[model samples]
Target: MTTTLITGANKGLGRETARRLIAAGHTVYVGSRDPEKGRRTAEELGARHVLVDVTDEDSVAAAAATIAAAHDGVLDVLVNNAGIEGRTADNGIVAPADETVDTLRPLFETNVFGTLRVTHAFLPLLNRSAAPVIVNVASGLASMALITDPEAPAGFYPGIAYPASKTAVNMLTVQYAKAFPNIRVNSVEPGFTKTDLNGNSGVQTVEEGAEIIVRMALLGPDGPTGGFFDAQGPVPW
Candidate 1:
């Protein structure tokens, strides 16, 4: 069977993706930091649970070992979905001028470094699969072209840290795809979905947001790699 692992699968887009992948006959592992919540969500979605706090190196390593032991050291797909917005109390993005090293560190810890930690730990297992896939859950805000275009909605976003971290994720996707020619590694834009990350302010639902993620996670060996895509199509770098 196709074995898949999704980080932050306890809720939101991650949970929905796990449910859909399970329904599609994948042996899905719901990766979360909380054991109780993870177990509950996995049970509800008919998936297995793996404890993973992407920001913690020991936690990520342990989770990888656990899944490796359970799945015979083979993981077909990995969805790096864990992230944070780092918005203020009023749900306001941090202004570019106010963005300092201290202000941006936390967001980078989880969204950028955490993604690399998990992907690095699971590389061995993913490599063992006949067709390995890596899906980095990026955002439209990470698009340089979209954010620079005067007419684009993302151009108006005031946040610097969050988008910068996701931009790093897109770079990671590109480098990983180049490093591992056999594995289909790509980043995806979920399209401003309603979730806790935005206090449910997004225009679309979780179902709509997970469309590109699910589509990319199910890519075959011959599928496109090293690209940033959304539900509509390829997103500009």
Candidate 2:
């Protein structure tokens, strides 16, 4: 069976993606920072639980070890979905002038650095698979082509930290796909989904948000890598 792991799978887009992948016959590992929440969600979804706090080194290592042991050091797919949006406002920046290093550090810690840490930790297991795939959950706001347009809606958002970090994720995705041609890796924008990340103001639902993530996570060896896509199709980087 295809074995897949999704970070931050306890709730929202991650959880929904786990559900869909499980339905697709994948042996899904639901990863979350809290063991209690992770186990509960895994049980509910008939999946396994891996305690993975992407922001922490030890936790990510332990989660990797656990999955490696259970799956014989082979992971077919990995979904990097754990992320944090900076303190948000209704539609625009939250204290645009006050967005500083201190306010934005935590966002990068989880969204960018955390993704690098988790992906690095799981590379061994992923490499063992006959066909490996990595899905980096990104945002529409991260696209320079869209966000730079004065008439574009994504640019109107007042947040900088979240979008900037996701943009970093986009570049990282491209680089990883280039470095590991054997593995299918891509970045996916979930659009504005109704999740805690957006304070539930997103027009779409979690199920809707997880569409591209699941699609990218399950890509075959022939599928495109080093690209960014959304539910509608290719999203400009």
Candidate 3:
């Protein structure tokens, strides 16, 4: 059976993804920063739970160790779905350029460093699986093509820290996929979904947003890797 773990599974796209994967016959670990919330959500979905705070190294390591011990060090899939939008104030006025570094620190710590920390710690367990897969939940905001195009809707948004972190995530996905030829690693843009991340002010629903993530998470051995994709198809970096 496929054993999968999803970060930030307590709510939003992460919870939705976990629900879908469980229906697909995978043993999913609903990973959340809050143990109580994680357990509740996992129980509701009939899945398991793992307490994890992505930004915390020791927490991530412990979660990995727990999963490793229970599953005999074999994790079939990992969804790096945890991320933060930072203090964008509803995507309004851009923060002063001088404050860029300070603002970006926490965002990068969660979106970029957190993903790496989890992926790195879980590599051993993932490597042991017959069919290993890694899905980094990126965003359309991370796309240079979409964000830079004058006519694109993303042009209206003044956020920097969030998108930049996702851009870094895309790069990390590429590098990890290249390094692990035996595993399928890829990034997926879930589109503008109505979730807490955006205060439910998006164009799509959580189901719609989770569609691409679930697709990439369940890719076959022959499926594409090291690519940025959306529900429609490839997204230009």
Candidate 4:
């Protein structure tokens, strides 16, 4: 059975993805910042639990060490699903430029830098697998072309910090995929889902949001790497 670890699996899209992967027979580790929440979510979903705070190096290392001990140091998939939607009053349009920067800084700490930290820590474990896969959970709003396009979906829901941070994540996915040819790395743009981030305004459900992520996580060795895809297909950079 493939061993997969998903960060921020206590709730939102992360939790939903974990549930789905468990059903598919993968040994999944539910990662969360809080031990109680992590353990509880894992128990609820019948999966293992690991405490992982992506923003902290010590926490991420500890989580990786735990996974190494459990699965004989072979990690099949690492889903960088933990992210934050910074304070965006009025969708951030009315906020000042400095406010945008201030808001985005926190989001980046988790969304962008946090992902790098976790990926770096677990890379050794991932390398042990015959076919390693890393899935970065991005958003359609991250697409510069789509966000800038008048007809694109992201153009309608404008949130500077959340959307821009996801853009960085999408780019990071490509760079990592190129860096690690043996590991199949891909970024997925989940369309607007009714997660806690969007104030539950999205039309899609969390199960729907996690579909692309779970699919990318389960890709075969021959699957496309260094690519960005939405639910339907390829997304413009």
lDDT by residue for model 1 over 147-202, one digit each (tens)?
Answer: 99889999988889998999999999999999999999999999989999998899
Predicted model with the maximum TM-score? 1
Q: Residue 215's C-alpha lDDT in candidate 1? A: 96
lDDT of each: 0.95, 0.92, 0.92, 0.89
- lDDT by residue (129-176, candidate 3, tens digit) is 988999999998899998998888876667788888999999999999
Identify the superior model by lDDT, candidate 2 or candidate 3. 3
Show where candidate 1 strays beyond 4 Å.
Answer: none
Candidate 3 structure, TM-score to reference = 0.96
Ranked by TM-score, the better of candidates 1 and 4 is 1
The C-alpha RMSD of each candidate to the native structure, in angstroms, is 0.7, 1.4, 1.4, 1.6
Better of 2 and 4 by TM-score: 2
- Candidate number that wins on TM-score, 1 or 3: 1
Tell me the spans in candidate 3 whose CA falls farther than 4 Å from its real position: 88-93, 96-98
Per-prediction TM-score: 0.99, 0.97, 0.96, 0.95
Choose the strongest candidate by lDDT: 1
